[model samples]
Target chain A: MALTLMKGSEAIAEAAIRAGCRYFFGYPITPQTEIPEYMSERMPEIGGCFLQAESEVGAINMVYGAAGTGERVLTSSSSPGVSLKQEGISYIAGAKLPCVIMNVMRGGPGLGSIQAGQADYFQATKGGGHGDYHLVVFAPASVQEAIDIMSVAFDTADKYQCPVMIVADGMICQMMEPVELPEMKEYKVDLEKKPWAANGHGFSKKSGRSIINSMYINTEDLTVHNQNLQAIYREIEANEVRFEAYNMENAEIIVTAFGTVARIAKSAIDDLKEEGINVGLFRPITLWPFPYKELHDAAVAPGVKAVLDVELNAGQMLEDVKLAVNGDTKVDLLSRLGSQMPTPEEIKEKLLSMREVL
Target chain B: MKEVIVLIGNYGSGKTELALNFAFRAARQGKKVELLDLDMVNTYFRLTDRANLVKSHEIRLVSPNFVHSSVETLSLPAEVASAFALDWDTVIFDVGGDPAGATALGRYKEDFDALPEGSLTVLNVVNTRRPMAGTPAKLVRLMRDMGRPSRQAVSGFINNTNLARLARPEDLRYGYEVIREASIASGVPVLYTTGRPDLLETFLSEGHDPAFIGEPMAIETFMHRDWETFTKEGL
Candidate 1:
């Protein structure tokens, strides 16, 4: 179809539908409620299932069940509601279920205001739940980027048999933009390819029964399982570390940011360029893979005086920037809590002041 | 021009944008104007967010507890009921998106019904990209649905189809074709079609038929965007 203007949440939902995600289980939570609301209307018309469960916890568990059957599944919620899905996410991770969990993050630690915030950086990149596991997280900077990543998310989840998360904030979710969608991929059940799926075979003696469970009674067996999961994470880290580096040739300062904040920084950088300021930006598209090595190179690039980490939360991504820089250069942070947006003017002022770091 | 004009449409269909533009258009013509945010739903990105801009235009704006209320409550202020008693040259009702948002107007149905004939005009603003307004049949359905809640017949149609900065002349023509068919079927005239000045300049420069698209109305975007499209793709 030709380009059409749409709310980011609705576009992402249509992207999921195009990506062959036929099963959606979610609860209503502002900023992200449009995903499930659009699904509720379009799912049945397409012979798919869209179930609004009693709670966020219930919805995620439903994702686990649907995922076990090797069907592409998706669930979305805001920050507080996403917190309730942690336990279920852990179970899905342990059981190695392939599904997508989208969070249109809002300001929070507890019932915080409904506005965009990236405070969930640690919760998403680090293991938010118990045990040694990771959810491949994609942090899209724009609505079109979010729509483009949904297809990759499902394909990556199925490829590694792991759950994935697409984290966006209200700034991107509520904004309207034009998007050219991909062709719809038809959903066909071919359990033969996913032999590990819990789908029932013909009950023939030749087909072996598959047990979809994370509970390992024996400590030694669990240890081996954990090792295998670590190996998969390593492969993902090597392959999926995607980031965008802008104006890094002989830069004076490098700013590392993601999501909508990155674009604000870009607007600042664009204006600063007119005044002969030499600056660059490094935006991480995949949060879990983190782009550590690439960021470090950008940080240590010739003529770089310092690295500025900008975010909507109180330096949540600052920790990651420091880890990536590894003390190769000094890292300063520009942060605000509670979804208070820093305009291009504020960001430019901060950048000018940060130049004193030299 | 009617004294009281109600602008209704689906969410993101540019209803609030048109409301703000209309109120300013009348106020600039040396006419007293009152703009009412009669929407009870839609927490964020409401017309109340731009009260300062409206005040500068000399148009009195009424809404829920606002003037940058951080709480973003979803109830209309009591002053909305008193808007009818004001002696303004024009009163524009900026209804929330969808037919359900007009449910709040039921309390003022008697006041609306009692208005002198032709003093009120209810216009259905449409962006045909939205499924509810995608076709002629769907347009008729939405027009009736919006009319039911406000207890007013939709007297006209406004085509406001867009795709942000990417909107081109052809998209307007395509939407106008469908909206025109909708107008014919519903017995409502195509009052006008809206586009930004830049878009309109390019639309006429491209040699599109003006008669096919009706009167073109120029409007500016009013909502806040934390960031901008800093690249050629305007992502």
Candidate 2:
């Protein structure tokens, strides 16, 4: 219960430690390297294992190894590094491993820049790695949200026995902010209860079988497995649609955004609200099973004219907004691509321009 | 015409190591080689610091201004494009990890495509530990998902585990087999095997350096060889 000024990436790393994450693996990359660097410096003090792997690939595999042991494990990387991490992420999902993966996105089609951008939204929520599986993804807009959602990310991963991703971008990772640490609680990880984990040689001998965390199985078995996965996904959809609304009452417009962009939108909303434009914000905390119903309601809300979806990419989130809004509300996009982050003033200007079009 | 072979791979799979060694080998052969470091993905492992040594050997060192910058294409200011348009014997573009980081290649695909038969070569580093580091099945699936089919690309894989700890030349050898197997299974060629230049020197001097030899082998041929035979015979 202490307040500290920290970068979003540093806060996430500290929160992971407090949340009982004792194993960390990561490769250093810009904007998000602080997470790994911080873990490398401090993980040893808590008798934790921190391995800065040969590359993002090795780091992710190390995570896979730790997760297999039912230990609290985490990995962090930026856009390019995250791209390298996709393969491991997919395998973790197929195996239904419990772990935390963080992507501090930067601008780019190729090593875009060290600057912030939201280009990886589609990649993160849609499953960056290959497969029919989803990682419970949390999009944090501030340092505090980074800590809070990361705490929830661990719980959700354990609850679902799936990998959870904390998708932040360069801005959130690099910017320093005031974070009031949450009340400390002893971290309790119950990997022993899960019959699936590879705890040690003794567990395997006692069980009289080697546990395999693979999706590949006989045709009938594979089908059953997939169906079960579907059930889990449905449960998540029903139970995990989380979002925050600001100034929705009597608002004529809903500014739909997430992560760092959403925070910027909130400031712009305040400015526009004072100007009597009645603009509100819908920031989705869980972007994976995107708060579709929340989006639908915002679009159909009384006096809502249009939903202005702003982002750091060239309209990646626009399509989702359109789908969720379902043509009832006019969907407009304000975007920038490749390392360019749109500011609050620019976003407000776009919102006003969208009103004119409406 | 001067040819440029760009080495592309995920981080820590040894792009910098391969590119550096390849540049030296090509230079020794009297080929006017220019090794360009477009590796903007990693903050370290840049070859720009050694550019003077490379230049002293009469080998051209063409790169963007920010050699230390991660994300080659985006950080290597636009001026580097003119360098690409030039006539060089070998131009190696050490791309960053992931296809998104290869965005610079988006424009040059056509240019490289126009190269006289067997001009452009893309060497992909494969490490068994990373995300796509799984079996060949996973690599194919990932390539397909990323929309970069290996069928047409002159893609070959070199297995290299650049891990500082628990990494020996043996780890590199294991990497070679995994990557070779995946390349063969995916219908890409096992163009070469990579290791630290010192370890690979004997093969390099014997003209057996698989890294520089232009081969037209496809993924099918790569996969056709028996796993045991290839491992023993050096795939």
Candidate 3:
């Protein structure tokens, strides 16, 4: 396929279609609104379904209903809207259904500005909804990575029978860049093939009927279900940790960041390297199953002096980096709150100042 | 050469980016260029945000005074009038997207009309990928909407068919065909089909004349998307 320029939101929508996601339910919100807009136009043309739910809550519930039938479904919204969908998300998680949700984050506590921010790191990685379950969260730094992650997010969701979240900021949502789309995939749903799907096969002769529900009135039964969900999360943590290490072989400083901030950190690292300052970058692509071991290793690398965490918010992800680094080294933060993004020069200066103190 | 080129279109149709590309193109050819940032509808992705890059190319940037300030105002700055008074070889107005945005142009309708006939060209920049202007009828409606507010007739169309960096040759052809239909309906000519240099090559190989396609614009994706943050090297 030839390279084409695409906005982050539209690219993700198209990639989901190519990945065989035939059902989409979403409400409009800034930054991420393009996804729903794109799907609304493209889905009908592809013989698929696109519905603009009344609200975020309504949208997530629609996703839950669709996923119960073993269909590839998706929904997207920004921070505040994502919050509204939490109750439904919790229900979907409890039901052990599979679906993809995207939260193109914006600054917030309440009705935050429509600009990129990493403030939702805790909500996403720590599980926003009331739950004892975890979401496989993929934080992509580029549109291409967003496309690639979205393509597999559905498969991963179905594999674990859980919801997967793609965490991006408004910057990623609105920006346009060249991307080579993946080949279109053909996925046919065979109702009879999946005994667990609610495909209207009543409990009678050949196949057993499926009941999709999260309610377990009995305390003991609920405990068992929670335990099983924990086991799945543990397995995910052990196997799905993904992080990219740059110039880590011999570095005096290790910089930890993710998504858009990570790329800015990389440019800073490049400049620092030119100035003979040994700095490295560790970007965690999966936020939930954070690359704890990899980050710890990088933090304690030979001759490493300190660890710095950069973000678009005031030190939300910094806590995660601190937990990963333990007491192995000193941890610091460089951040710009709200919609502000730090430039490479700003990051480079911060790193240099940290080096002086070290 | 047109003394003034006015770019108007629906929101998110890549009008600001196209204006920047056109300004740089004229400056590279050693033409004295002045860029007017009349976009007040969108606070982000405006030409004023890239003042340093524009000045680096030796192009004078005229922007609304309220731009980049905490206060958002729709009033055109006095500098815009000063820009019109200048004797620059080429002056490009990066109008706000949409008809509401084009209302800013009404303030300068008199000055625009004073220019000799054919010296001013209003090009409706169309990105077929955008939902609002995807079809010829919708595009004709958009042109009409913008034209009514600017009080100037659209002389031609610029086919900016793209899916961002993922655009292919077929996308351009698809957009060109729609624009062709739109041109007939609106009685406007299709002045140029613009896109990234690489994708434009595919259009040419398919027998599109360079003159018809216009010079391929090397647009820098400065409006940072999430992908640009991590992938430093590639466009």
Candidate 4:
């Protein structure tokens, strides 16, 4: 075990590798490119599989192939590249395949820029791929959190038979921060326990018949399958919502954001507090199944006049805040689009503007 | 005024194919079009390859040749800017897949300030199977991710129908309407439709900003028709 400085994206890759991820497939795209590049060099050294796929499409499908065999699998790409892999991601979700997907977000609509951004919030949390499915979406704002979440993501995926995404932005991917590596536990997955995997079913009668994650049988059966998925999602929502709250006591404004935007929000909140402005922060650690109840309570607190939603993209997460607050509190948006990130000073100015309205 | 077209879209939505087609059409129209390969993501097919096709029509092909084809950063060479200062009829920047590539545009954004405001069109390809393909809310978010409020930036999107092969006109029409409505809602504009080559006549005749080509039409047609259907319905 060793403590070292690592970029958020690199930490996730290294952590997953140490956690017994034997296969890695990805197409290089910005923000998240270092993960695959790192794995490309590191995986071979550890006697693992590292493939630079023909395209993002090919990379996710390759992940499906590996995951179907009950292997530890991972893929990383940026927003545009992740968009290309949606079909495969949806298929993986439908199949209940356990794998890791990392999206280092950048600004967009089309060809936006390579700078750090949190614009992919909705896409990552609301099932970016498709179908009535959910992924364990972990938003890691710091490099250490990024590494910690990788193990959590893999475990969550395995526990629930689902895919997981370590959703970070370009800042987390590119910035270097100190990390204390946890004691590495080398793992050898017992595919024998996963009878549903594509591994040959002839090993033991107790292993049962192999299974696939498709819902293509009869319409009613498909409906039943969908209902089952809904139930699973409900279970996840009930049990897995997570977040971090800082200095809410007697606070006037609760600034909400996730990923890199959250870190900026934190800095803004701190700076405002120093200036005698009571601004608090509620940062969601798990984006999907958003920490709505915490946000609701935060909004309803006395003297909490307004909530400012900050993001790299304009007003995408603001809608969710609206839904969460249900009009009990006013929601204001201070946002930047494409590759531009709102600095702490900018966010502080926004909070100051909320003074009159709140 | 220099018209700058920034080709953009989800992969498999045919942004590249449309860029190629636009290059051909713009060059054919006797406009001094410079095809700039700004796509740093996908390594394979790039606008750089069609330099001859554009050169034949006197369309200047401008791109920095990297030692490695796989490198994804598109740095606007100084020469390209020098040419831009000189009166090029149009400049097409085949920007990479998403905002990451768009960030690269920040370096050359000053160059764009020199062009007429409305002439800079950011082409959004509507592909259904891709993320945010069928949802307007998601599309709006995608726009936000690209940068907000698109008013000063993205003027319009090009609805390129799955690389333009096996694409029904209905898909093209749907993509047009959805993106058009999105643009209107966001105060941007839907410039034109990118679909099958045959449909090019329809758009050309209709004067829909000149038809743009879509994807790997032959292979993606049958399998990725969901994109076509989504684009059609969205429009």
| Docking class for candidate 3 | acceptable
Residue B222, candidate 4: how far off, in angstroms? 55
* Tens digits of lDDT, candidate 1, B149-198: 76777777888887766777676777888987887787788777888887
Per-prediction CA RMSD (Å): 3.0, 18.5, 5.3, 20.7
TM-scores for every predicted model:
0.93, 0.61, 0.79, 0.61
Whose TM-score is greatest here?
1
Give the TM-score comparing model 1 with the true structure, all chains together.
0.93
Candidate 4 docking DockQ:
0.01
Worst 10 residues of 4 chain A by lDDT: A1-10
DockQ, ranked from best to worst:
1, 3, 2, 4
Pitting candidate 3 against candidate 4, the one with the higher lDDT is 3
In model 2 chain A, which range of ten residues has the least summed lDDT? A201-210
Q: What digit string (tens of lDDT, one per residue) describes model 4 on residues B1-235?
A: 7777776664445665666677666776878777777666543345665566657877777776461333444455676675457777777777665555555566776667777657777777665433235455556666676653222266566665432333455555555556655665776555565455566455445544332322222211222212123222210
TM-score for chain B of each model, two decimals: 0.86, 0.69, 0.91, 0.71
**Candidate 4 lDDT score at position B105:** 63
Model 4 quality (TM-score):
0.61
lDDT (Cα, tens digit) per residue for candidate 1, span A204-300: 5326776788898899999999999999999999998888888887689998899988988888898888899978999999989899899998898
Question: What lDDT is reached at residue B174 by model 3?
Answer: 85
lDDT of 3 by residue, B1-235 (tens): 4489999987667788888888887898989999999987666678887899899999999988777763466777688876668789889998988787899998788998888878998888888876567789889887887878899998788888877655677888888778878877777887877877777777767875443455455465554433544345322
Off by over 4 Å in 2: A183-192, A201-210, B1-235
B68-130 per-residue lDDT for model 2 (tens digits): 544434556565565457767777776655555565455566666667876766766665544
Q: Chain B in candidate 3 has what TM-score?
A: 0.91
Model 4 residue A157 CA deviation (Å) reads 0.4
